[model samples]
Target: MGFPAGLLVLLSVGALPCQPITHGDSAKQDGHCFQVLPAEEGALNIGRHWGAATPAATVHIDMSKVTSTASSFEFRTLDPEGVIFFGDMGDHDWFVLGLRRGKAEMQINNIMTNISVRGGQRLDDGHWHRMLVMNEGDSVRLEVDDEELLALGHVSYPIIERPVPEMRLAMGGLLLPASHLLSPMNTAMDGCLRRWSWLNQTTTWREGAALRAKAKPCFSALRPGSFFPGAGLASFRPADLAGGTAPPNGSWGLEVELGIRAPRQTGLVLAVGVPDGSLALSLVLQPTAMVVRLGNWTKLRLPLPEGPCLDAPLRLRVSPTQLALQLGNHGGTLPNQPPDFQWLQGTWLGQEGRLFIGGLPDGDKTPRPQEWGAFRGCLRGIRVQGHQLDLDSALFRSDTIWAHSCPGAHEGAEAGRRARGHGAD
Candidate 1:
C-alpha cells in the first residue's frame, strides 16, 4: 500500500562507476566482467572517482515515513564519465562505485580516514548494473548483490548532525553524465530510503469523523408540512391529509424535504402520504421528495396508486380498511397492508396535490383537556432553531378534522380536489 522514497538509476552490465577512472585490463567472473585498474593508481583513482552518470530521473526520499532498516537502495546504471570497479579478492570486479564524495586532504600517511564509498554491485558486460547502499551504525556499507565489499568510516560536519536525513535523493544531476546504453526510462529511475515507524496510524481526516465532528443525522421537513424562507417547503391543503376525518377514509399528499442520508439503507423508515389516494409517502432519491401509498392497513396489504401522475396537488383519503388516492384526478393509488406492529401507519408530504394537508397521526386515542392545546393533521407553521427542528413549536390539532364534506376548513384542500378531478379528465 505504500512506496519507498528514492530515485533508481539504470546501469548497463559493464559500465564504469567513474568514467575518468580508467582500467588497464578488463576481466569477467560469475557471469559479469569488470574493467581492471592497477593498484598503483588505486588511491589516486579513488579520490577522483566521481559517479559517472547524471541520471535523467529523480527520486524523492521522504524521511518522514521510513519503515525499513535493512532495506537496500539499488540503482542499475552507468555514469557517462567512466566506470570504477571494487571487490574483496581484487580479482573480481563485483561492484561499481556509482556515487561517492570527493577525496579529502589527509595529514596521515597512506591512510585515507575520510574516504567513504557509497555505491553497490558493478557490471562486467554492457548490461544491467546494480548499486546498493546500506546503513550500519553511523556509517553505510557498500556491497555487490552477493560479494563482501569494503566498509568506509563516516565523518560528519557540524551542519550535518544526523546522516543528512534528506539528501537531494536524486539521480541525473550535473556531476554524473547521462548513461548511453538502453538506460531505464528517466521516469523509471526509482529508489527508497527506509526508516522505523508503525504504518497503521489514523490520519487527521479519519480522526475528525470519529470525534463526532461529522456525525449521522436525519430530518423530514416535507412530512411535518412546512417550508424554510427559501422556496415553498412542504405545501399542502386540508383535503390532502391522510387517514381521512371519517372512519375508513384516507387522503394523500407529497413531501419535498432535504434528507441528509435518506432511509433507503437502514433505520426506522417513515413516509408521508396524500389524502385517500393511490400514492403513499415514498422516498424519491434523486429529486428531494416522498411518494405516498393509497390504502389502509389490512393484514399486511396496502394497495398503491399507479399511472405516473407526477403532477401538482395530489390527494389522500384514509379509511380504517383502505386508503384512496386522487392525484389531481389522474387517480393512481397504492395499497400496502400494514403488519400488526405498525408504528408509522400513515403520513404524507404534499408536492403534487390541489390542496396540501399537514397533520400528525400518533396512536393517541384521548388526552387531558390541557393536552389538547395544540392541533394535529395540518401543519400551519414550524420553528427552527440553529438549523434543527424545535419540538416545542411543533403544533398539532387532535380534533380539527379535514374530511371530504368539510374540506374548506383547511387551506389548499378545496383547490386541490378540483385540481385532482381536472387532472383525470
Candidate 2:
C-alpha cells in the first residue's frame, strides 16, 4: 500500500474554516459538508495544556513498513521535560523520544531490551535542533544537528526487525493515562516542532499532521517558578529515582532547598512524610513564624523578622544525627534528633517515594478542598536531593498551581507580545 494511503490523522480541534479534502471529498458532487481543514503555515506549535476541557495535542503517524527505516524531525523548546512522542507497536514494544532534563532522549523497549540514551544537556536554550533517528543494524541510532551520538548513546534492539503499527507524538506530552515510568515529564511542552520527515512517506506536513488545539502564535513562556495558590498541590515520583521506592531505612537522607515568596500569612509550603500518619515532616508559614515539623515529636517555630520582602532562602536537611534548617539566617539546628523521632531512622519517607509541594485536599469534599486550608504562595526554583523539580511536568498537580500568575509579573512577556524570527544559523 502507498505511504499516505495507509496514513490517518487524529488532531483535536479545527485549525481553520472549512477546506476541501485534498484526498478529495466523495460527497462534494452532492454539495454536502466534508471533514477537516489545512494545517497552519510554518512550524507547528503545540503545548501541554491539560484539564478536563483541554485535551492532548496528539499527532499519529503510520510506520508499519519495516523496510523503510529513516526518519527525521526539527525541534526547539524552552521546556526541559515533557513527552514528545510515544510509539506503540501493539506487542508491548514501543519507543519514546523527548527531552529529559533539557537533553534529547530516546527510550526503547522490547521483549528483552529496555534502555535509554541521552544527548547533550541544556538543549532547551530556545535553540533550534535538527535530529536524525534511524536504524543501524540491530541497534537504533540518534544524532543531533549533525553529530552522531556517542558509544553509550545507541542500544541493541528489535525495532527495525518488525513493523511499527501505531505511533503517537503528542505536541507537548504523552497521551496519558499511559505509563510515566520511563519518561517522568508526563506533561506538556513549551516549544515548537516542525519539518518532520519519516521513511520517505509521501505527504506534506500539512496533510500528514492532525492539528489539535489551534497552533498558538508561539510565545515566550514566563517560568518565574510555579505559583501555588491556597489549596494547590503537585506530586511526583521521578523515574530517575533509584529502585522506585524509599531506600534503606538507615541510609535515608533528605534535603530541600527553596526560594520562597509567601505574601500570605498561613500556608503549607512543603511536606515530605506520611500524609495521614503523625510521621510527617512539613514546612508551614504562619504570619511571623516559619514552623518546621520533624515528625510529631520535634517542632521548631522560628519567628520571622518584621519587614517587607516576604521572601527568604529556605533550606532543610535531615540526617541521622542532625536536623538542620535555615530560613534566611534565622534557623537553629537540633543535634541527635534521630532517637527522638525513631521513625526518622527507619522510614522518614514512606515506601511510595512521594513528595508533595503545596496543599493537600480532603477526600470528603465534592471538589476536594484543602485539609487544613491551603498554602497561598509561590515556591520558586525548588531543589530536592540535588535534583531540580519541574513543577509544570509533575505526575499530578492541583488546578490552582499556575505560571504567570505570581504577582508583579511583567505583562509584556505574555504570548504573542514579542516577535522572534528563527534561523538555523
Candidate 3:
C-alpha cells in the first residue's frame, strides 16, 4: 500500500549526478531555450553512441513552441539531417517516432515487418510537452507528458539484426532525400527543446551555445484540453446503459459540444444505433467537414471553412428532420433526406442498440479501434432527448472522464441552441 521501492529510491536520491547544463536563468522558464535544426542544415549532437551492447535506452525531452502543422515526419533524431534513429540500417528498418498526419506515431521496421501505433491525440499544438521514448528488451514505448502514446512489442529484431553503427543522437532535419520509396522530410521543427536526456545523461543549452543563441524565448502557454487527464473522455454502448436503450420516442434532439484538437483525421463524435452497426444518427468529423449519417443511406456533409479549429468548440444538433452544425459562430444545416424510416423517426433512439459518444461501438458494444474513427478531442455537455447527460455519473467515470468543460462552453451551448432552432424547418 506504500510507494514502490524503486520509486522511493528515485525520490530519495534527489537529482542524478549528471552535470547541470544551463544557459541564462534556469529558474525562468522562458530564459532557457534550444533552437530547432534548420531545414537544410544544423543539429545538436549528443555525442553519444548506442549499439547492440546497449540495446535498452530511454530518452526524455521537454519541447516548447511546436509548429501548428507538421511535416512528413514531425520530429526526428539520431543524425545531422533528421534521419531516423538508425538510418544506416536502411530507411525501412529503422526505428522512428514522430507525427503522421498530425497524430503521434511510433514506427519500427524489422526487415520483414513494419509496425506502427498512433496516439489518440495530436501533439503539435504549440505547447510545452514532455516526451519519453524507451527501448527496453524487445519492446518500445513512446509517451507524451507521462501518458503512453504508443507501445510496440517484439521490436528487438532491429537491435539484434542490424550492425551497430556509429550513431549520435540529433534532433530535427532529415539526412535522407525525399522520394516515393521514403517518406518526405520537408522542414525541420520550429520549436524550442530543453532538458533532453538519454540513458541518464542530460543535455542543456550550455553544451551548445551557438544553437542556444539562435533559439528565441517562447513563453506561450499550451492550450488546454490538448491531452485529457486520467482516462480521458468516456465512451458508451447501448448495453452499457441501464435500460439497454436510449432517447425513447417523441421529438427529441441531441446536442454535444466538442473541443476538436485534430480536424484532419476522421472521427466518430457520436452515434446512436443497433447492435449490427445500423445507426439512427451518426456524427463524424472529417478533415474539412462534419458528416452526419442518418439511417442507412442519407448522409449530410457540412464543410468547415479554411482556418484553425484547434480547441474550438463544435456544437452539433440532430433533430427528427435535420442536422445542424455550428463551429463557433459559423453554422450550417442540411435537411434529412427522404425515404425516412422508423429509424429516422422520433422513437428511433429506443431501438435495440447502443449510444456511443466519442467513439463507435464494436459488435460487443465496446469502443472500437482508432482506425474505426475514435474521436480525438474533448467532449462535454452532452444533451440527448432534452436531458443533459451526467458526465460525472458512475458509469461514465469508470469509462474515463479525463476532464470537463469544453472550450467556450457557455457561448457554444447558447449558439448551439440558437442554431438548432434557427435552422429548423
Give the runs in model 2 whose Cα sits over 4 Å from its true position.
1-55, 58-77, 84-123, 126-170, 174-221, 236-253, 305-309, 319-322, 334-340, 349-354, 364-371, 387-408, 411-425
> On residues 3-91, what C-alpha lDDT tens digit does candidate 3 reach at each position?
00010000001122222122334213212111111111122222121111111112222112211111111122211111223222334
Off by over 4 Å in 1: 1-55, 69-124, 127-130, 156-165, 174-425
Estimate every model's Cα lDDT from 0 to 1: 0.23, 0.52, 0.39
Residue 354, candidate 2: alpha-carbon lDDT: 50
Q: Per-residue lDDT of 105-167 in model 2, one digit per residue for the tens?
A: 766665646766677745665555676666554556666788875333234433444445645
TM-score of 3: 0.37
Maximum-lDDT candidate: 2
Residue-pair clashes per candidate: 127, 3, 7
- Candidate 2 Cα lDDT to native: 0.52
TM-score, predicted candidate 1 vs. hidden true structure? 0.21
Put down candidate 1 lDDT per residue, 48-70, tens digits, no spaces.
Answer: 11123332222233334434323
lDDT: worst 10-residue window of model 2: 1-10
Worst 10 residues of 3 by lDDT: 3-12
The clash tally of candidate 2 reads: 3
Q: What is the TM-score of each candidate against the true structure?
A: 0.21, 0.51, 0.37
Worst 10 residues of 1 by lDDT: 102-111
